[model samples]
Target chain A: DTAVSQTPKYLVTQMGNDKSIKCEQNLGHDTMYWYKQDSKKFLKIMFSYNNKELIINETVPNRFSPKSPDKAHLNLHINSLELGDSAVYFCASSQAGGGSTQYFGPGTRLTVL
Target chain B: SQQGEEDPQALSIQEGENATMNCSYKTSINNLQWYRQNSGRGLVHLILIRSNEREKHSGRLRVTLDTSKKSSSLLITASRAADTASYFCATVPTSGGYQKVTFGTGTKLQVIP
Candidate 1:
């Protein structure tokens, strides 16, 4: 079984549309994260959740919101998406806090036309 | 500015040779991690070295951390075509709980036969 799983491996939608990417990790990890990789392949952290508590929400636009229904499930909802929002979104999970290694999902390719 | 920037945006090496990549960060970190991405897939954790440690090894990979210079290096021994992928360095901030991991741009490695 995949330790960390993400749904909608590919998402291609028009601008202004709202979409949600679902992530789940069965590793019993306490921390989950959402990352965005731009065309330049620069990976940036968008949000982090620990036991369903909002931790780090980077300077992302208001259109992007992360909802953690529970410790195992973390979803990202982007409203009124723009063309600039096109990128690869990754979901990751880690067992302990800061010094540990992270396990990543396959990622969802979100293309806003 | 990005927290970690990898040097030699890309590298090509012959089979059986060794490949080296460097990463530099601007802030203090509690630990450094190395991950490998194969093609368009999610990243896989390779190794991690704490701030107090200088070197670590796993399988054919060797990671060196220099906290004084705020830099790190990943060395792959006996490179093979199977090792072709992108290598990234992630920094776990010293002050933040392990959730604040920031990834570098990555170094693309192509193992030539």
Candidate 2:
């Protein structure tokens, strides 16, 4: 079974449009995260939620918001998507503890035109 | 900003050869973990080494940690073409309450058959 999964694997949208990506994990993990991989292949963490509680919020713009409906799901919504938002977004999950291993989902490739 | 940076942005090797990747971080970490990501896919957990542990081995994968130097290394012995992927080092900061895991720049490995 796929421990972690993401929907809308490929997204192409116009500038200023809004989009959302969904992620889910069946590992019964308590923490979920959203990461952005730029064209240079630099992966950066944007947000992390533990048991539906916001835990870490990086220096991301307010246009991006993450919502966790439950411990197993975390979704990212991007408002006013710009050309800079053209990158891969990855979702991951892990158990709530130090040194817990994280499982990532197939990334969503976003393209802004 | 990225807390970790990996050396040798890319490596190409023939199958049956050993592949080594090094990572250096700028902070005190509770643990360091290695992950592999195949092209167009999610990241896979490879191994993890705690701050107190010096080295760990799992099958053909060997991980070494040096907290004093804030560095780590991942070695894959007898690497196969199937092992070709992007390797990343993630560090769990020691101060964060929820332990935000930060990823390195990553090393892309291409194993030729």
Candidate 3:
């Protein structure tokens, strides 16, 4: 079984549109994260949540927001998508230990035209 | 910005060969972990080494960490074509509690059969 999963694996939309990507993990992890992979293949962390509490919110733009309804699910919503928002969005999760390894999702490829 | 640095941004090796990728970070870490990602996909956790430990081995993957130097190395033995992927070293900074697991740029490995 897949440990971590993300929906809308492929997303194509026009500029000024709004989109949301959902992520879930069945690994019994208490923390979840959202990372963005640019065209250059650079993976950058955008947000992290622990047990439904927002812990890390990187310098992501206000147009992008992450919401965690529960410890096992975290979703990202992008408002007024722009051309610069075209990239792969990955969701990951890990145990709540001080030091733990994260398991990633299949990734959502967002392309704004 | 990335919290760690990976050397030899890209590597190519033949089957049955050994490949080594190095990572260096700037801050104190609670633990270091390795991840692998296929092209256009999410990352998969490989291994983890605590700050108090120097080395750890799992199957053909051997990881070494030197807290004094703030560097680590991931060695893959008997690599196969399936091992051709981007390897990343993630550092869990000592300042945070499991939410700051930052990833490096990653080293792309192309293993030939």
Candidate 4:
């Protein structure tokens, strides 16, 4: 079974438009994370949620927001998307606490024209 | 910010060869983990080594950790074409509570059959 899964494998939108990406994990993990991979292939963590509670919020712009309705799901919403937002967004899950192994989902390629 | 930086951004090798990737971090870590990502896919957990541990091996993968130097290395023996992928090192910092997980700049490996 696919332990972690993401919806909308590809998203192409115009500048200033808004978009959302969904993530789900069947691994019964308590923590979920959102990461952005730039064109240079640098992966950076943007947000992390533990049992639906916001735990980690990086120095990302306010235009990007992450919401976790339940422990099994986490979603990212970006407002006023700009050309700089054109990158791949990855979703991952892990057990609550430090040093836990993470399971990642197929990334969503976002293109902001 | 990215905590770990991997050396040798890319590596090319023939089948039956060994591949080595190094990662260096700037902070004290509770553990270091290795992940592999195939093109257009998500990251997959490979192995993990704790701060107290010096080395670990799982099948053809061997991982070494040096807490004094804040560095780690991953060695893959007998690489195959299927092993071509990007390898990343993630560190769980000793601080930051639950937000300590950080990924490194990945090293892309090309294993030719």
Task: Give DockQ per model, in order.
Answer: 0.77, 0.78, 0.65, 0.80
Judged by DockQ cut-offs, is candidate 1 incorrect, acceptable, medium or high? medium
Residue-level lDDT tens digits of model 1 in B1-113? 68899988999999999999999999998889999999999999999899999999999999999999999999999999999999999998877544488899999999998
- Residue B87 alpha-carbon offset, candidate 3, angstroms: 0.1
Any runs in candidate 4 off by more than 4 Å, and if so which? none
Alpha-carbon interface RMSD of model 2? 1.5
Worst 10 residues of 1 chain A by lDDT: A93-102
Stretches of model 1 off by over 4 angstroms after superposition: B97-99
> Any runs in candidate 3 off by more than 4 Å, and if so which?
B97-99
lDDT of 4: 0.93
The best-first sequence of candidates by DockQ reads 4, 2, 1, 3
Q: Which one wins by lDDT: 2 or 3?
A: 2
CA lDDT scores, all candidates in order: 0.93, 0.92, 0.91, 0.93
Selected candidate, larger TM-score, 1 vs 4: 4
The TM-scores, one per candidate, come to: 0.97, 0.97, 0.95, 0.97
Q: Write the per-residue lDDT of candidate 1 for residues A8-107, one digit (tens) a residue.
A: 9999999999999999999999999999999888899899899999988889999999999999999999999999999999999999764588899999
Q: What is candidate 3's TM-score against the reference?
A: 0.95
Q: What is candidate 3's lDDT per residue for A20-98, written digit by digit as tens?
A: 9999999889989899999878888898888998888889999999999888899999999999999999998888743
TM-score of 2: 0.97
